[model samples]
Target: MISKLRFNTVVGKKVLMAVTGLAMVVFLIGHLIGNLQLLWSGAQFNGYAHFLTAQPVVILIELGLLAIFLLHIVDAVVLLQGNYAARPVPYHTKKWGRSKSKRSKKTWASTMMMWTGIAILLFVPFHVWHFKYHNPVASARPDSGQVSPVVVGVGSTGVNTSGAASAPSKEAYDLALQVTKEFKNPFVSGIYILAMILLGLHMYHAISSALTSVGANHPRYQTLIIWGGRIFTVVIAGGFLLIPALILSGLIDPAKTLATAQAANNQVAQVPMGVGK
Candidate 1:
């Protein structure tokens, strides 16, 4: 069954794509919720980021998400190649050409899926590196628009179940500081907005397509599925867009509740490298 579900057969490949696409949609919804927290407070957003990175469970979840993304993209490329091979040339050249061009103009969302996917693929690695892997050094002086961070260690200050002091815990990175720096960049913000719009376009068509491919085709529910696709695109993409928009617009202040560069560095200076986790 597993072997049959690989990429050899067209039906199997479509099913796989539908499954993976839906998985990504779930991730997008969760990510959007996390990011929307940025609108409330820097500490909240930073704390959320710290929560994701400081726990092993979150790391495992991240790994699983990465695998899902890889599978989706790889499978999509294979399917695309198979489609091109199966129809090397239009059987009815003039007739097919006119209709294809008309369809392209009419359904821009569907037509641009492959191109938008490629654009998003190119942007994600840099985004993850900038926001996740790299951190601003605490010693450097950040301008009003720029920011950096240092990880802070948790102390034995928590009240235990028996009303005793709990043991000291691990350190957590200052993610808000890092995010503020990245989002404050006009160039980066611009590109991110563009990529997200592209992502929305990709999702708009993808949602309905996945539903159809997966055989969610009851006439009574078809309209709902189609509308659901649109709603998902707007909600997920618009939710994700809010963070950068707030930062760029100066609504989310990096220095308001988030850690300052000097403060971050000072907190982590005594702790050894990699001890924050």
Candidate 2:
């Protein structure tokens, strides 16, 4: 029986789906926590973002995440194709609930899992483009004849006035600030918040279902899985929501915050020269 199942193509696809889905669930939790830093303040969020790209270990993790994302997408396409192939004939159904109640009784959230997955896939590239690729606000150019400012403690990846490295640019920072400023626009902010809510809904089902698909469905620990899903959903979604709320409230203004810090640094630089004279 075991060998027969192993040889089955459907079984192989199921295993692939389970593994990739679970990996993505873990990534989502980590990403949500990292994004939560935006709620504390602009400096805090920017520093956190900077730290992620600057660290070697984090860079490796990001590569792993990219791999997982690709694997999940590939598996999803394969599984979807297999599912369609298995049901090539269209059945005419007069009534929706005429079939087995066992299937109908399954949670609606779980049934809609594929739709949620599609939504997430659609959202990700837009998110990456907005925050990472072509980031306009974070780039900085050095003053004439001065080397670019070395992002202190940024090590080898740090930006310098010379602009030798594509280190986080002042342009990226300004872009980030401008993006946040848009949150003040009711329509834009509303859409962002709604997208986050959909993300939460997607995670809520995906987390526990992925576990169950991976042989964690035994009755002995099912309750724990359910509670874990709820908690994970709340924490991740709740934390992310705080960022938009704070931005809309004007509690975090990236441009103003950066300008203030730069002014203070300039004042400190001049103070020592005046004292010596």
Best by TM-score: 1
Q: Residue 45 lDDT in model 1?
A: 69
Q: What is the lDDT of residue 26 in candidate 2?
A: 75
Which residue segments of model 1 deviate by more than 4 Å? 1-7, 91-106, 136-172, 259-277
Task: Give the Cα lDDT of each candidate.
Answer: 0.66, 0.59
Could you estimate the TM-score for every candidate?
0.75, 0.70
**In candidate 2, what are the lDDT values of residues 63-169, reduced to their tens digit?**
88788888878877887888789888888865446265644424655667678777777777876766554332222223333333322211222333334543433
Q: After TM-score superposition, what is the CA distance of residue 247 in candidate 1 from its true location, in Å?
A: 1.2
**Predicted candidate 1 versus true structure: per-residue lDDT over 1-277, tens digit per residue:** 8865565689888888899889988888888888777677656765565455434476578788899899989998998998899987776534335375643322678778899999888988977776645453222212212222333221222211111122223333345555666788888888888889999999988898899889996789877877798897998888778778778888876546544544644354345544442
- Give, for candidate 2, the lowest lDDT window spanning 10 residues: 268-277
Using lDDT as the measure, the top candidate is 1
Model 2 lDDT on a 0 to 1 scale: 0.59
